[model samples]
Target: MKNYILIICAVMLSQVSSAQTSQTADKKAILSVLKMQRLAWSDNNIEGFMEGYWKNDSLKFYGSNGITYGWENTLERYKQAYPTADHIGTLSFKINDITKITDDAYYVMGEYHLKRNVGNATGIFMIILKKIEGEWKIIADTSS
Candidate 1:
């Protein structure tokens, strides 16, 4: 009976450790996704920047103008809005915080700055990211 109890205890401890490791990996994946976005934007590659977003019709984005649905549509909107080097400029992101909502999801709060010929616009972004098929992607985002 003692041996059985020890085996059960070991299993329970392993489960707990696995949970912690999963959470750590989820947080790292989310941060990497954000970093990829910053790099892609800095390169003035809207298509590459879109790689961070979930490639699904249900993906959503909200900004100063309003809400946009669909991953492709969001990419199109970005391309149209920033059509030139002067418009795209350089991008920077300051991630304030990242919180895990569940094993597969996280919430991020960050500040984004874009330097353009017209001027600079700085705003805070709230994002919801999900781990889908071993990849982290932004499912929803809102900024102002």
Candidate 2:
């Protein structure tokens, strides 16, 4: 009986380790998406940068001004704010933390900095990312 119990515990430990490994892989994939967006932003490729976001009418973005709904609307807002490479500037991200809410959801807190010939700006941002159809995408964002 003791030998059987020991075998069961070993199996349970193996399962737990497998789960942790998978979770770590998922986190790396999520971070990769953010890194891709940061590179796209620095390249002044708004469309490419938006590839990280969930392209749906239900998508939401909140900033100091107010809330904006829909992916297209958010994209338009970005165009209006930036307009040209000169305005878009060089972008960088400092991810402070990432918290997994569930297997399908995660939240990221980070700071974004923009360096432009016109001026420079920096702010903190929180984004909620969700895995949909096997792809992770940002569903909501609030930035100051």
Candidate 3:
């Protein structure tokens, strides 16, 4: 009876430990993706910035103009609209919060600022990141 109880407790403890480890790993992955995005923007590499987004026809982005669908279309729009240094400017981000909705998804709220010679634009963004095929990618984003 003593040995059986000890085995049961060990199994339960292992399971709990695994759960916590998985959660931590997921959080780290999500944050890493966010960091990559900031770096890509700071480099003024529109293509690099697109790396954070899901490369799918269903990916969605919404801006002041309206909703845009598909990853390639969004990239094209960004490229055409912000083609020069005066427009790309210096990018900065303040991550307000990141909440895990599930093992595979997270909701992120953040502020973005672009300092340009012409003018500065600042806005808040809410993004939904989904882990697809063990990789974290932004599935949807909405910004003012």
Q: By TM-score, who's the top model here?
A: 2
The local distance difference test score of model 1 is 0.90
Compared with the true structure, what per-residue lDDT tens digits does model 1 show for residues 13-131? 99999988988888887888878888889898889999999999999999888999999999988988889878888899989998889878899999999998868878999999988
- Which predicted model would earn the best lDDT? 2
lDDT value, candidate 3, whole model: 0.90
- Mind giving the per-residue lDDT tens digits that candidate 2 earns over 1-144? 999999999999999999889788888989999999989998999999999999999999999879999999999999999999988889889999888899889999999999987799899999999999999999999999
Model 1 TM-score on a 0 to 1 scale:
0.86
Off by over 4 Å in 3: 1-17
TM-score of every candidate: 0.86, 0.95, 0.84
Q: lDDT per model, in order? A: 0.90, 0.93, 0.90
Candidate 3 or 1, higher TM-score = 1
Q: What's the TM for model 3?
A: 0.84
**What's model 1's lDDT at 39?**
86
Provide backbone clash counts, one per model.
0, 0, 0
